[model samples]
Target chain A: MSITFKLDVLKPHQPNSPTLARALKQIEGVKYVNIRVEEIDQKTTSIIIFIRGNEGLLLDKIVEVLDGNNCALHSVDEVTIQDD
Target chain B: MSITFKLDVLKPHQPNSPTLARALKQIEGVKYVNIRVEEIDQKTTSIIIFIRGNEGLLLDKIVEVLDGNNCALHSVDEVTIQDD
Candidate 1:
């Protein structure tokens, strides 16, 4: 199975999109990660992240990574699971 | 190159999500299509569509198909192009 997620996140500027993407890519089963900055504030950046991975993809781990980075997950905009 | 698009559309309920997805899959180069209905009014349905395809995917053709189905494209939320 392959799972794809579209997540909205708000985080401080320290871990920019590249940093965030790299961190997420390190997660088990993660195959693709794309982070787009939607808005920028003096201290924070609002971004949309798209991740595609296999069945090993766990939402809990994803959330944990974001939390570790001091990022707040606003919402999970979309999630799709497809059988390979 | 492969492209992914996230589109917001509003249309009558006649051509439901499944119908819409089938139509979109017929487009050249489209490999995956997922449509999720977010809101339902008495006469219309608001949906978010995610499409993945190769370089052959054309935005004009997508819009044309939606227009043919009387769908109003509210916005294109995201677009990503990646080299394969």
Candidate 2:
């Protein structure tokens, strides 16, 4: 069983997008991460992130990771679950 | 100003420690991550992780990342803040 979801995130403009992507991929069961920048300003960048994993995604964990990265989760846009 | 901390984490035995190390390093301001195995069983592995960052480290974000990786945080052992 696995699941996928889209998240809207806001992060500071330092660490860069690729770093965030790599960080997210380290999550257990997380197989893929696609992050697209939607908006950027002097302080922060808004991104749309899609994550797919082999099981139920942990929302709290995701938030914790983002907070550590100096990022914020705005909303969960979409989700899909597949049982295997 | 920067801060460093040590975390005790328990995770499933699939994703290697290096992966977790890489993930933690991606957090903004995080300059280094050291993860050592404390114990391992058939189902999970216990690890001690140290993270150093350029500023105050966000505990919430670390937890989120851990959760996504299917890991649980047991305790935070040490902390140091350096102002530069």
Candidate 3:
């Protein structure tokens, strides 16, 4: 089975979005990563993240990467699972 | 606050992936959508979905879209919320 996650994230408005995208794409089974800015505050930026990967989608690993970059996880908006 | 969700989805191997992506992108506050195939069986395909959008992400609407297409949502893998 494969899984996909749609995440809402908050991050400081410094590190480029591509940095986060590259980090997420590096995860095992992660096939694609896309980040879009939702809102821009004075210091923080709200973003939506989309990730596609294999069955064993590592939520923790993704968390670790985001946390390491000082990004906070807000909420999980959607999930989809595929299996034969 | 904005929210993002990573979803694992199951879909039949007929409708093109872009169709789903386009449908998702049409959602309000949905800035981007990415879908990737993980495993392909004889009849089904495992896919991972990533969606980024504003704070008021309507999970039900997304579910409605997937259900309308005969797709099943298996799990929500990740959620990130961004707030100032």
The TM-score leader among the candidates is: 1
Evaluated at residue B41, the lDDT of candidate 2 is 90
- Candidate 1: clashing pairs of residues: none
Q: What is the descending TM-score order?
A: 1, 3, 2
CAPRI quality of model 2:
incorrect
Write one digit per residue (lDDT tens) for candidate 3, span A1-84. 455778889999867799989989988989889899999999999999989888677667888999988899875555554432
Q: Compared with the true structure, what per-residue lDDT tens digits does model 1 show for residues A1-84?
A: 577778778999987778889999999889999999899999999999899888668777898999999999875555665546
Worst 10 residues of 3 chain B by lDDT: B14-23
Please report, as a value between 0 and 1, the fraction of native contacts recovered by candidate 1. 0.00
- Between candidates 1 and 2, the TM-score winner: 1
Find the candidate with the highest DockQ and give its number: 1
DockQ of each: 0.05, 0.02, 0.04
Report the C-alpha lDDT of model 2 over B1-84, residue by residue, as the tens digit: 555667778989978898888888888778889999999999999999988776446777888889888999875544444335
For each candidate, the alpha-carbon lDDT, in order, equals 0.83, 0.77, 0.79
TM-scores for all candidates: the values are 0.53, 0.49, 0.50
- Output per-candidate TM-scores for chain A, rounded to 2 decimals: 0.96, 0.93, 0.94
- As for DockQ, the candidate ahead, 1 or 2, is 1
RMSD of each: 9.5, 16.8, 16.1
Off by over 4 Å in 2: B1-84
Candidates 2 and 3 compared by TM-score, better number: 3
The 10-residue segment of model 2 chain A with minimum total lDDT is A14-23
Alpha carbon deviation, residue A56, candidate 3 (Å): 1.2
